[model samples]
Target: MDIRQLARGTVPWDRLERVATILARRYDRDAVRVEFLAADNWLSIPCIVDDEWFVKIVTKQHTRVHALLTAGRNAGALSSGSGGFFTRFETPLAMVEHEYEATQRMREIGCNAPEPIEAFEANGLGVLVLEYLPAFESVDDLDATRVRALAPELFATLATMHDNGLAHGDLRAENLLVADGDLYFIDATKVLPDRQAAARAYDLACALAILEPRVGVRSAVAAASEQYAAEDLLDARDFLDFVRLRPDHRFDSTRLRSELEKWAALSEG
Candidate 1:
């Protein structure tokens, strides 16, 4: 029961058909029963590839885009006035392969990252079959009370990732899905090791703002940050440039900084 299924021809049927063929040949299953669990630029098709699985298929067109993106990243890294930005470009297939490696390493580090069951190049696309999370809900639909309770755990998970030198560049409510009161992260295209302090701080600040919809902005940033610091993740003042990036809602950066200053002074006293 997928929204796109009802509205056929809405998404790229040609791409799905092509990927389905590849899956059928690879898994020795019927492509006719291929169903999408979820998708964005990449298609998450549900299939039985020796067992229950969600196959994430990335199209060749997207890989070409990744190549272009890699070029851009290299240029940006070279042109960056400071040593803050990194310049590593990966092709689409390489990207999926790298993600698989990162997942294994992160698991060893005790971080909650999804692992791929199978990863390879197929149908001119990067095919990554991964273990799907069962019975989970994004924080967006959760209430303020529930979010407040989970807030500390969320920061703790982030702290673990940072301690191991990884940065989940995108930390939003959607990317954080809770199952049984624990957190698991997804969409890790930007997750990398040896990340800068600024990048890690950005992840924390954005996470606080993401909780704003569930809790008020100031309250979310302050409360979560208190645990974020007390948990030895980071000092609140480190998020001096804390600002909500989503233009739909404006959370004042100046107010955030001033509030953090007071929170720190009070903590010291």
Candidate 2:
């Protein structure tokens, strides 16, 4: 199936909710929220079960298409210039299984990650339900002051996770949440198995990039650096060279890189 073609428009609510019956068995039908997420290449939908839990469905088609697209980036799915599109479809049951396992692994290793409540197939679609963190707030909602205040704890969470040999590959600001004075990491699909320092730093850098615009590069870096040893900490500078080259990040790279270079020089002095 051509996931790109199929995802062109909003999918029919009824067509997508063939799995609602499964949800109704666990949650009130009236309270359930079926949201078809946008901007993703996959059929990503979540059934918000009245703020109690979330039933996340990642279709087999998306899982396969996503893999093909990744391979296409190098092999060229259709044509070298096409930047091509390769799609695949699989049994829905297999789609959510990997994520479910990953989440459990993170939780097992003591990271504040979500745990699976259930994993099953519904009407040929793969679904994994999880414990919803209703009180958590996205990093996007945080201001410079809030970010600075919590920077230490945030850094500690990443550092500790890194020290333990697990990496949260998707540490986007939104994926990091604060609730009740602690941090919670979500979206565990990309958790890496090795304890490579570079991978850990990459996660820290991802969060810092998102925070840079909000807290200013120096303040953001300062707050985060305070918690970890600068000797071998996850240096945002390393990732900056490549990350800032992207269009969205270019505008701030010069200023951020300058501040970082100054910081490095001053620390050395």
Candidate 3:
């Protein structure tokens, strides 16, 4: 089994059946087809219902993992000379509900995101339902040329979120999807309300880290410069080393930092 599968744990077959039954009843169907996805997710058991609705079954274990990850992220923030900005949910339902609301907020702010249907508890498990995108590719799955073309829009969307007082506490290539030629964000994590600046810088750092490996340091920094000011980019620099520590992000941090500093200097001149 994959490491993520082990970390995500497994829901009992009967539990999944109960969830399917509940979904069938909620959707007014006699029965529903559940196709579990082998997603590299550590927080939930993701599945598709009748190829129409995307569902995430969040268990107690998932909540525990989320809390632990949040705590680690908080520590990372502290290392960047900022207070902890990441927030943890005490229950599975809270996790799903926050993600549901965050997705809605992103859409309300004119950003592309899947339509959140609902979040509810089924037999003590947190269940979140959303519209399924039949066709999409994660940024990580895209070619370098496509990623290069999409880089500016990615930063633009991030800027829009920041300008609207919203921050995607979790920003990574896998969390960003391209569907029908548009970028869609998913799985936004919770952050402290009063620590938007820290969260924003972290998000910027993650974006740069994601793009640098795909498009090179110069292109990544250039794309980021279009949406973020020199000072914003510099602030993001503080979080580069922290972001690099994540296994999901692999990039030449030293080179990326040099490129960012060069760009900032040129902007200052």
lDDT of 3 by residue, 1-269 (tens): 87776777888999999999999999999999999987777899999999999999999999888988989988988888989999898888998999999999999999999999999999889999999999999998999999999998999999999999999988998999999999999999999999999899999999999999899999999999999999999999999999989988999999999999999999999
Cα distance off (Å), candidate 2, residue 160: 1.6
Runs in model 1 deviating more than 4 A are 1-15, 24-32, 37-51, 63-89, 191-194, 217-219, 230-243, 247-254
Candidate 1: tens digits of C-alpha lDDT, residues 133-194: 65678887788899888877787777777777776655677778887777777755453345
For each candidate in turn, the TM-score is 0.72, 0.72, 0.97
TM accuracy, model 2: 0.72
- In the order shown, the candidates' Cα RMSDs to the true structure are 5.7, 6.0, 1.3
CA lDDT, every model vs. true structure: 0.59, 0.61, 0.94
Writing each residue's lDDT as its tens digit, candidate 2 over 1-269 gives 66466753333556566676667766656535565434343445665665667677766555665565445332321232222222233555655776677677667766676668878877666788888776878776777788778777777777777776766654666677877766777764332243245455556656667767877877866766665555433365566554444333423766766766676666667
Clash pairs, model 3 backbone: none
Candidate 1 worst ten-residue window by lDDT:
80-89
User: Which has the greatest TM-score?
Assistant: 3
